[model samples]
Target: MSRITFEDLEALDDDDFTEDNSEPMDEEEQDRLFSHWQSVASTHQVSIPAEMAGPIQQMTRQSNAREPVPFATLSRHEKLDEVVYEERMYPAGKWACVTKGEELYEQSISMAFMKLMRYICKENSAGRYLGMTVPVLNEIQISKDGKSFVRDILTAYYLPAEFQQDPPEPLDPDIVIVQREPVRVVTRVFFGTTTEETISRQISSLWELLESTEDFLRDTYIVAVYENPGIPCRRNEIWFIRRDQ
Candidate 1:
């Protein structure tokens, strides 16, 4: 009887939608990621400086190929409408993560990626080298510009929440069997979005937009971000992988 706007459709009364996951925050992505970072920290030497995070993320933000753009210059959706995106958050590490896992062929790499990710997310939510994942079907290759790469891996069956206690899914047999590539060597953050689609076409659109630009997209360090339930996080961040200078 009443006209429901897009925003209205996007929003429903709290009473209308009860929380799906039972133990929302208790055993989710945060624990999994932080745990991994914690384990890796003992092996590394240098500690991340406190103030460097802001600048590091700023450096990673995608800018215009021709000229510099201000953060204030664009609206929020304008920034996120992209299929593939780059983001810089705290902890200073950067990444080029995506949303989908089904696009790639060899799902094993995805498993390895997840294993490495859980190690980080469970160990250090606040450390260098955050974990993130994006969906791509093409071979993950480093670019001539030396800033981007395209690799594909199949990641069968992803858990929407609570990864800390969850076992690694998508065993070798479960995957579609496409192609696999080692993750680029970079320090990164894993930000993901539940509202987003991780399928190949969507990822391709994201990839194409970046590919057209003078800036390169190679050795794309893909990280997967699982949003916290309580936080207003539906979509996630996908920053480019950092290259060693």
Candidate 2:
């Protein structure tokens, strides 16, 4: 029989795998499979590459169960038969934000997330556990070429209501407290894992639905991810700040 390599496994479509039709593996079974793969690689004197290791890691990782920052739904309207966007009013609140400069949106957000996570996890001047919040907001500035992102990609975590009045100051210089003003945004929601390509497509779809109107700012937009990387069918959104507000 021909050896089924790691690349071969990666190349297989969802329908090609028997496990696709099977029930989701429990934690114990996931652990067993993880260990089994490690043992196989060890016995063969080979190492698992990152592409393969990532999915393996994700399979065993826990999802973020934090509460989302509160917002008031001002109104909702159907832009398309399949797409319903909303107008939301987010009250003035405090947010812990980090700015990262990287070409890739994923890479920049990943780095900034760690810093903001540390701030909430008690790496602050007050040494208080601030807890976590969902739908991390990433504000992206597209490059001049319009094909890639610029240096300043700001990632922010909304401070929970309890800490909105007096949030702990971050010890890390890169992490700053942003006092956001009450503003209204028109947002469109989508599902699945987010990437640069996916984000662009969503934004373009939103733009077309909005008819490239002057109602919202077009210079930059906000990308919000409500779930952690481990979660499947994750909720994501594209937010355009209304110019009238």
Query: lDDT scores for all predictions?
Result: 0.30, 0.68
Q: Candidate 2 lDDT, tens digit per residue, 189-237?
A: 9986456788889888888877558888767789988754433345899
Candidate 1 overall lDDT versus native: 0.30
lDDT measured at residue 83 in model 1 versus the true structure, 0 to 100: 28
Residue 128, model 1: Cα distance from true site in angstroms? 19
TM-scores for candidates 1 onward, in order = 0.27, 0.71
The best candidate by TM-score is: 2
Q: Flag regions of model 1 displaced more than 4 Å.
A: 1-106, 113-199, 207-212, 218-223, 227-245
Model 1: per-residue Cα lDDT over 1-245, one tens digit each = 12323343345332222233333333344343333323222222222233333322221221111121111111112345542344332221122222224323223333333433333333233333322222221224444675333333322222222332333332222322222222332122233222223423334455554534423344442433332211222233343443432
